[model samples]
Target: MDAPSNVVRLPTAAPRKPNNHRFKEQRAAGYEAKQASVFRERYINPRVRAVMGDAETIMGIEQTPALLIASALFALADPDTQQKAMEQLAPGAVVGRKAHIQAIATMRRLRATTIGEQYDFYNAIDELEKRRS
Candidate 1:
């Protein structure tokens, strides 16, 4: 049988493996270490100091969540926004309004201190929202 003259053929290449191993190694060496230090310095230490203050009180079980809520609210820039976020996160919690007020006071006290990048704070809140869902 005679073949048609308009026939075309395409060439294929072998699939290449991803070079993700090197990327993981580099990230572990640099990014992870840097992130750990930053997290400890910026988030954990500050929250601990805020909760503990100069005089140490025995940390009760209930105090952990309270401290966390306060810290998250304090991270926000505005009182109304913090209140709204708290309301959204804990619809009927009694502490929502109180946390908002405390957050406002904290914000005022730390007004001169920089809060790092706004995007980072928003991203953290987004992640927390996702976890709640």
Candidate 2:
């Protein structure tokens, strides 16, 4: 079967993954890389930029002097005064019960079939409020 060796031949390698499988793997890797890039661009980059900007702004003179003075005044205050101030700064109790009450009231005023049929359905969460109160 010997002939003139003038034709160029394609190179071959040992069978590892098939060509189609190799391409699929590469395509999947590319997709993951793109997804990571998009997430960073869409979320991480903006948040980092915002934090850096806020930090820079907070470091400026207007904020710096005020914070320093407040800290000094806070540190020098009497213990009871500090305790009262801290209590004042602390968040008060949530008014969720009142919100539910208002919601139930509003629902009662809505145009239901019997003008008050809405009370039964809307009053369910109100029971939770009653138990809590």
Best by TM-score: 2
lDDT of each: 0.47, 0.44
Error of 2 at 53 (Å): 21
Write the residue-wise lDDT of candidate 1 on 4-70 in tens digits: 7886433564355556675778877787678768465444333334433211212112346876676
> How big is the positional error of residue 82 in model 1, measured in Å on the Cα after superposition?
17
**Model 1 vs. true fold: TM:** 0.22
lDDT of 1: 0.47
Candidate 1 deviant stretches above 4 angstroms: 1-101, 104-115
Lowest lDDT sum, 10 consecutive residues, model 2, at 103-112
1-133: candidate 2 lDDT, tens digit per residue: 5536996444675445555565787899988888878465434233333333223323232435765576567666666776665454334312434333332333223323342333433343343345457
User: What TM-score, computed on C-alpha atoms, does each candidate reach?
Assistant: 0.22, 0.23
Go through the candidates in order and give the clash count of each.
0, 0
Q: Clashes in model 2: which pairs?
A: none
Q: Which one is best on lDDT?
A: 1
